[model samples]
Target: MKLLETIMQRAQQDPQHIVLPEGNEERTLQAADAILAKKAAKITLIGKPSEIQALANQFQLKHIDQATILDPENYDKMEAYAQLLVELRKNKGMTLEQAQKLVKDPLYIGALMIKSGDADGEVAGARNTTGNVLRPALQIVKTKPGVSVVSGAVLLFTESPYGENGFVMMADLAVTPNPTAQELAEIAVMTGHTARTLGGFEPRIALLSFSTKGSAKHELVDKVVEATRIAKEMAPDMQIDGELQADAALVPSVGASKAPGSDVAGHANVLIMPDIQAGNIGYKLVQRLGNAQAIGPVLQGMGAPINDLSRGCSADDIIQMIAITVNQAISLKHNKDGILH
Candidate 1:
């Protein structure tokens, strides 16, 4: 199957309710059209009704309903939410009108939708900075209980001509520039949970570093070692090990030589990097050079699994991220029951 087909399959199964911020943009409008045409789920678009309608007509796109467009101009409808928005932005020197303008912004609107259960998830950042996309989510939706840091992961998949599938998840690629050991552990645990939830397998995590065990000496290696220990303690039932090199973590023969009798060394599906620099570079290399289909830098460990899109992302990227977000949300709901569902 093509990459888009794989993404569509996941979206169809989950059909996550999604909100599109900045829906007035051409790309955002196109994405909303695609989602609606696919009968994927309910999609709320943030924009002025007339502006959105004009764009839809210009593009000859169907399913462009006025009700689906969330207009910030509807002050009466937005009164309570607008007030909350003002309170949140008061420190930024925003007056009531300015706060209202910001609230109408697609990022802020989408974040509010997620916070209020108006949407299951959101996809944004095509025309916004990473900070712009994440700020509202952090401020309003906040982090999950006991989760102090927000991190991200990419779902890397490789498929052969005959259709065999292989996947590896990498974390801290888009968030946490220089993570402490505890922060790294949080990333590890969060990434592991996401791998299982979205990728459909029990995650075996490898805390990747430049060395296997104590073979190399560096603060980075020490960080991975401590993170691995912390992750194990935090989720005792989780299968995780760390301080392994890339080759050891990914190659069976190399893993056997480097770390004897380890469960996660070669078979690990979730790889928690020592920091963002390595994780970001590693996943992109796999995607651009190794021909793997990279599905995210999907943000995790927030109050919910609200994901941000690459400004370069296609409509298909938004669809896949929504499906992944659905999986994360459902898994979180099930986990809160104190048993796997």
Candidate 2:
């Protein structure tokens, strides 16, 4: 299938609300129009109304009828919510006025929308840093029950022979720079959950390192070992292994030889890296050199599936990320229901 087709498939599965925190109104309006036209999801563009309208007019784009354009300046209903947020973050050395000022930001407001159930999920970071995109979510949306750290997941796609497609997930590429073993374990568990949610399968997670089954000795390898142990203890039902090199994790022959009886040796769908430097470089290498279609450095482990888009992302990228976010939201809701039942 084509990229657009895959996007539409995911979008049709869960048409939740998607908030875009763009800098300029015209671009945001254009995005809103595209999302609505495609019947992808409910689009909410956050910016100044007048500026957005002017850009819509200038671009000869019809006003998005179904779209809700939000201006941070006019979100009066969120005042109480913002004040609460200020109080919550007071320990971070922010005064009430300072907190109020920060909460007025589009990023903070977008996060509040999710927290308040006004939006199902959000996609931001076109003009914001990864930290900027995640900070508000961390502060307001918070982590899930028992979740201590937030991480990132990238969906790597490639076409195999016979027209089949494959997916591999990498974690902590955009979030933690130097994750401790405990943090690595958290990332592995979170990435596994995300993969199962969006990729629609039980994920075999591999905690990747330079060594495979203790063949190499290094601090990083030790970290992966401890992380794999922690992850297994935390998620006893999850299929996970670690201290494996990429070749052993991905190649059937190498895995069969290196890890004789391991479950995740060659069939791992989720890979947790030791640090951001490796995760970032590895994903990009696969995308650029190996010609894989990389969908995300998507933020995960938060209360919701709030995502980030590269500033150079196209309208199609926004559409696809929105679809992924919607799927995540639905899956999360479904899991919650199952637990309650």
Candidate 3:
């Protein structure tokens, strides 16, 4: 089965509570209704109760009733959520008045829901900007412990069988424009974990560079080589190799000739580009010219599963993101309890 199909199946089997901040938005509402119909997740919609109901009625959505809608202005936990937000941001000199004002916003409410353990995960960004969607999450839910930066990963579904069953995961695609060697190493480790937990495969990670194993000597190549060593140390058991050229990383014949006797050189399923410049250009080239389907810029390395969608996203996109968030939440729970799933 496809990775997405497997994810949806898993989500249905163990449905999680997902909060949708853009409750009255058309695509979000449609996606929420579809999710309820599939029993993929229990949804908490944050918006005005009357407005949500009116939108549901206008769209003739039957499953909207199955979702729990919390009005941003009148939620019972409004004061509690404000208090929590103030506490979280107290060191930043955030006053309770400021927190109360923010709690009225849907995005903040949704994030606070996750922070307060009222929800398992969150999916938003249909009508909001990426920065707007991420602000509350960063302030409240924050990054995972020991993780300092958040990176974005995209799952490239290609026709060529180069990666894991024709699926390759690329990272730092949407966030972290120019990461240092240390941050790059952290991105590598997080993306590997994402592959194992969400992609349902052992990760063979290749940190892409212009040079292949000292064939060329430059500071850029050195950075990649250092990142590779750091990633290996960070995740010693995982398969990771680096300072490899793109051709060496993907093509077996080229890999063997370029980086002899390296495990991940030819068999890498996750490709960590050196910077956002290379990553964004590379994925788009493959997506458009190579005729591959790119599934995400799935936001990883968060304390909880909170994903952002494109403003031009369809209901189907929202549904897919919801499933991705559910799987991430499950994976995070397992890791927290020291259980391998």
lDDT of each: 0.76, 0.78, 0.89
Name the top lDDT candidate.
3
In model 2, pairs of residues that clash are none
Q: Write the per-residue lDDT of candidate 3 for residues 157-224, one digit (tens) a residue.
A: 99997989789999888889999998899899999888887888889999999999899899999999
lDDT-best of 2 and 3: 3
Q: lDDT score of model 1?
A: 0.76
Give me the runs in candidate 1 sitting further than 4 Å from their true place: 1-14, 86-101, 159-164, 336-341
Model 3 scores a C-alpha lDDT of 0.89
Q: Per-residue error at 214 for model 2, in Å?
A: 1.3
Ranking of all predicted structures according to TM-score, beginning with the best and ending with the worst: 3, 2, 1
The 10 consecutive residues of candidate 3 with the worst lDDT sum are: 332-341
**What residue runs in model 2 are displaced by over 4 Å at the alpha carbon?**
1-7, 23-27, 93-95, 160-165, 336-341
Per-residue lDDT over 145-190 for candidate 1, one digit per residue giving the tens place of the 0 to 100 score: 7788888888788652211147777898998999999889888888
Candidate 2 vs candidate 3: which has greater TM-score? 3
Best candidate (score: TM-score): 3
